[model samples]
Target chain A: MRVLIPIDGSECSKAAVDYIKERPWNKDDSFLLVHVVEPIPVDIGIAYIPAAYTPDEGAAFTQSEALLQVVLGDLKSVLTNQIDTKVIAGPAKAEIVDLAQEWKADLIVMGSHGRKGFNRLLLGSVTEDVMKSAPCSVTIVKSAHCSKSE
Target chain B: MLLNLLSAPKTNLRSLTNMKILISLDSSSSSQRAIDFALSRPWAEDDEFLIVSVVDVDRGDMSMASAMTSPNKTFNSEAERIVSEAKELLHNYLPQHKLETRCLSGPIKQAIIECAKNWSADLILLGSQGRQGLNRLVLGSIAEEVLRDAPCSVQIVRRKFSRREDQS
Candidate 1:
């Protein structure tokens, strides 16, 4: 089986990785870790003249690559299966579902919430969107904090 | 650093035995596929399963009134049949493991979650109706709502891509 996991360097995402590490998976199953870097939105204002400032694409990719490497090392310690990593820049909701469909993933494992700052307000639009359009099975792993509260 | 972060405090070793799994099933084909997917996975020898189907008394006005009035005759038999069918399917494959069937009457989502919490299930496996477009917008998904509030990890099973492609 092919499993796709989307991470965002959040505490909940780490819980998802831990869940995958503890689960009993087949020896031949493969896992792919995908991290999507949402592009910084450009300000569109009609009244004020803004300075010419472009978002640094290079820095964003570098950070995403480092995160993936760290996650890969952690997963490798527990799993002996074929593990792969990919860093993409796009809307997380669309990229995750598209990647799962393109890769023909059997299952998608992810955290209930992502690394957005205002977590209390925007609970998890990315997860909600992925769950809506995923072409395969989806597993939503809640963090220890969330589960304990219930 | 990453390894340390990933190491959440686990109370007990999550071994492949004695896992309590709660499977929520309804009369939909999506739920039937969920059972098939559950049986396909590798489970521990001593794992226990609770196959449940909620009567959804609040869904229909007539059923709600009947549930309050007659109680026994209020779509309870349908829920019993749903759970029994799932139990029979699993029993053929896993005869040694403990299998229990239950019929619940209440709101569908709340009943499933309440049962899972009381049972202290390790995992909740259910099927998504796979609703899309305007229908999806109008009617909310129970699987998604369960995933949000479930005490344990929730797995929303779906048909394979190959099978879906063949059908389309």
Candidate 2:
């Protein structure tokens, strides 16, 4: 099985990593960890060009790499299968879905803040977007702290 | 074989030790896909499964004539059959696993959430038909609601896309 996990350095994303670690995945199963760095808005009154990587974009790329490394280290302790990481700069939802499609991921597991009411409507959820567009199964893991009970 | 755990005493003993999984089903093929996804996954030996189908009695038009004719009976039996069929399929794959089935009646999303809360399920698995655009907004999505309100983690199974489908 091919599992794709998207990380964003949030508590909810960490919970998603924890969820994956706890599962008893097959030995032959492989995993791909992805982090998408949304472009930083600039106030320049000129058309932006993709020819050169801005310093801000470079820093975001570096930060995302570090994030993936930390998650990969944690997964390495429990999983011995082939685990790979990718860092891309794009909208998180669209990038994640496209990566799943390109990689032929059998499952895409991600974290959701699980916001409710007006908050959810206001914030809009990347997890929800990915769930709608991903090419394979999608599992939304909520942080244990946020989960509601009777 | 579908076993009803409503009155089963072993639930108390096994509740804490096993992972309780609540799988919501309907008459749609998407629900069958959810069951198939569950069967293909690896589970702990003692993990218990509860298959539930909620009969939305209020859905569709309820006219006096049809109401007098006992549409509730038909809806309930259909719900029962859906759950039992799902249970039987899962039982065939995991014959030794503890499995139970129930037919619930209420608003579909609320019933599923309430059942998961009451049963203390560790996970809730269901299917999403991947309805897009205007259809999704107008019809709304039960899977989305359950995922939002569920007391446990939720996995939404989707149709497997082949390379051929992707190309087209």
Candidate 3:
């Protein structure tokens, strides 16, 4: 089984990681951790954008990369298996759903606050979009503890 | 057929509370897929399963409710049969565990959420019809609503497509 998990380093995102820790696993099953970095507006340095990279965009990419490493490190300590990690930049909902399909993930596990930007936005919940569009099963972990109810 | 641990790796056996699971059921094939998926999972020994089927009924008129009550009573009987059959099917699979079945009358999403909340369910399993794009938005979905306001976690299970369906 191939599982895809999207995280954003929020409390709920860590909770999702915790939730996965409590579940059972199989030997051949692998994990793909995805972190989507929302694109920063290019307006900050548009005059210099046409040449090299803008400062704002460069800063944003660096931040997202650091977060991905932190999350992967935390997961590596808890899990003893083959785990793959990827960091992409795009709209949170579209990127997550697209990656799950492209990777042929058997399941997509997302946390309550895993979406980028504000949790609930005008475009609809990012988690909800992934749930609706992903090519496989989707499990939304609200509370870190599976036994706990909201 | 049996491997080691898949993705969700850990098995925290310390918290030994009986897991309350609410599975939203219907007469659709997708719902059966959800049940099959749940049954195939390696649940804890103390896990308790609750199968609930909701009969969507308008609040305006209880006596003339669409699915809950009909002049010929077809919908009411079918709803009861579905839930009862599900209970029996599940019993055959996991007879040692505790199980309960209920037929609720109300809006599909509201009824399922209410049952899950009252039961203090640890998890909810729902079947997605796999409707796409405009259709989903126009008709909405019970699974969507329950996911937003559920008392606990929710899993949306989809039916596995057959080889013949894949070609199309």
How does chain A of every candidate compare to the true chain A by TM-score? 0.85, 0.81, 0.77
- The candidate maximizing lDDT is 1
Candidate order (DockQ) = 1, 3, 2
lDDT of candidate 3 over B1-168, digit per residue (tens): 011112334433334245688988877777777787766665667889998887764432344455344533655576788878888878888889899988887777888889988988878988776222126563237677788888677888865633233222
TM-score between model 1 and native? 0.80
Top-DockQ structure, candidate number: 1
Better of 2 and 3 by TM-score: 2
Looking at model 1, give its docking quality level.
Answer: acceptable
Per-candidate interface DockQ score: 0.33, 0.22, 0.23
Query: Distance (Å) between predicted and true CA of A146, model 1?
Result: 4.5
Which parts of model 1 have CA positions greater than 4 angstroms off? A41-57, A121-123, A146-150, B1-4, B7-18, B59-74, B130-134, B138-140, B160-168
Candidate 3 residue A148 Cα shift, in angstroms, is: 13
* Candidate 3 chain B least-lDDT 10 residues: B1-10
Kindly report which residue stretches of model 2 are placed more than 4 angstroms away from their true locations once superposed: A41-57, A114-124, A146-150, B1-18, B61-68, B130-140, B160-168
RMSD of each: 5.2, 9.3, 7.3
Candidate 2: tens digits of C-alpha lDDT, residues A25-105? 766778999888766446545454454334345656666677788788889988898899999878778899999999988
- Tell me the TM-score of model 3: 0.75
